[model samples]
Target: MESSMKKPAPDQHDFHFWTDEKFRIADTDLNGHINNNAVGQFYEAGRGEIISSVLGPPAKRSIGAALARVQIDYLAEAHYPGMARIGSRIARLGTSSITIAQAIFVEGRCIGMAESVIVFLDKATRKPTPMPDAVRDGFTLLG
Candidate 1:
């Protein structure tokens, strides 16, 4: 059966983590607009920040999460040599995974948005595992 899943919209109020990153000349394509890969990288950085804040230091945590899927939508072109504001938040939580919603804005205008699924896993086995209560509570507070 076909599933009906809709993309999430950019909502500033939904995000708890925010960061600003400057785009370099290398990030732009021949067209002088930021490349799709660079946009994804920005989102990844935002996710990493959120994970660190919610789950503690990577070196201290025994269990970690892995990126399972990512869906990004490009709405406008972003030029290089400018700063982009990134925002991220927890959109959904499951027994062993969480969905992160993120957006990229250039000069106060949204240029792209993304949703990513990350699965909690055992460090030794690299298999899915239930999220700890503390982690779940942390997500709740951020959400």
Candidate 2:
């Protein structure tokens, strides 16, 4: 559980960014295709970038916080030695948590998509905390 809350369905409009990632040899699996885990990793990169931008610093654990949920959908296949472009957007921003949606595209086609809900918490008590103003400011929609 990520504290008490409700989350609406995620939509296309939730995406707000794009990131480019180069595939490495280790990123491939025995099948000679990019591992499924790579897709989620790219999504996480995008989320970290956005969170850092909003917080005026690099993204971290935010004291006692941690990733709460991750839902991924694989659409197509990704080959090795290719480029992965990741796109991201905020779907939900709650009092103590935020939901982000991300998509992985290779060779101009979507290969995967993921949604993650991350929570903020008090470092000492490990309880949910209000999203700091600095962090919320990065979400233009809420302004």
Candidate 3:
């Protein structure tokens, strides 16, 4: 089955935050290219950096963030023995959620892109809650 959650691909210039991840030899598959799962992990790493940058460390924040949904589109093949340059930015920010748009590049060429929806949760109740003003303000700068 195909997913209909596609969004526009982002260029490197559109990113507000950048993360470079080394490709592990183990990330390769029988086809000798980085596997689809590795591409998803690249997005995860980018999102982690975004969260850390916008929300600070876990102990410093009143609320926790959780991944609600992610849609990845693979556009090209990436081989091992190189770095994956992942770029991330806030595509949308809501009262309790933020949507991150990201892309992965190898050798300056875009290989994949993803959109991740993250929701803020109350640490005590573990339920979605409104984000604090400070947190919202921080993310706004990345948009």
Best candidate, TM-score-wise? 3
lDDT of each: 0.87, 0.74, 0.91
Question: Of the candidates shown, which would achieve the greatest lDDT relative to the real structure?
Answer: 3
**lDDT tens string, model 2, 1-143?**
57565344334344557789999888888998888777778888877776665654533545445689998877778887889888787778898888877877787677788888988788778898998786676665522
Q: For each predicted model, how many residue pairs clash, with residues at least 3 apart or on different chains?
A: 0, 4, 0
Q: How accurate is candidate 1 locally (lDDT)?
A: 0.87
Q: lDDT for model 2, on a 0 to 1 scale? A: 0.74
Which prediction has more favorable lDDT, 1 or 2? 1
Q: Comparing 1 and 2 by TM-score, which wins?
A: 1
Over all chains combined, what TM-score does candidate 3 have? 0.92
Residue 50's lDDT in candidate 2? 67
- lDDT of candidate 1 over 33-121, digit per residue (tens): 99988898899999998988888788888688899999998988988689988988888999999999899988878888998999999
Residue pairs that clash (backbone atoms under 3 angstroms), model 2 = 14-89, 15-89, 16-88, 16-89
Measured on C-alpha atoms, candidate 3 has an lDDT of: 0.91
RMSD of each: 2.0, 5.5, 2.4
Tens digits of per-residue lDDT, candidate 3, 1-143, equal: 96688666667888869999999999999999999988888899899988999778878978999999998889999898999999999999999999998899899899988889999999999999998999999999988
Q: Per-prediction TM-score, please?
A: 0.91, 0.79, 0.92
The order of the candidates by TM-score, greatest first, is 3, 1, 2
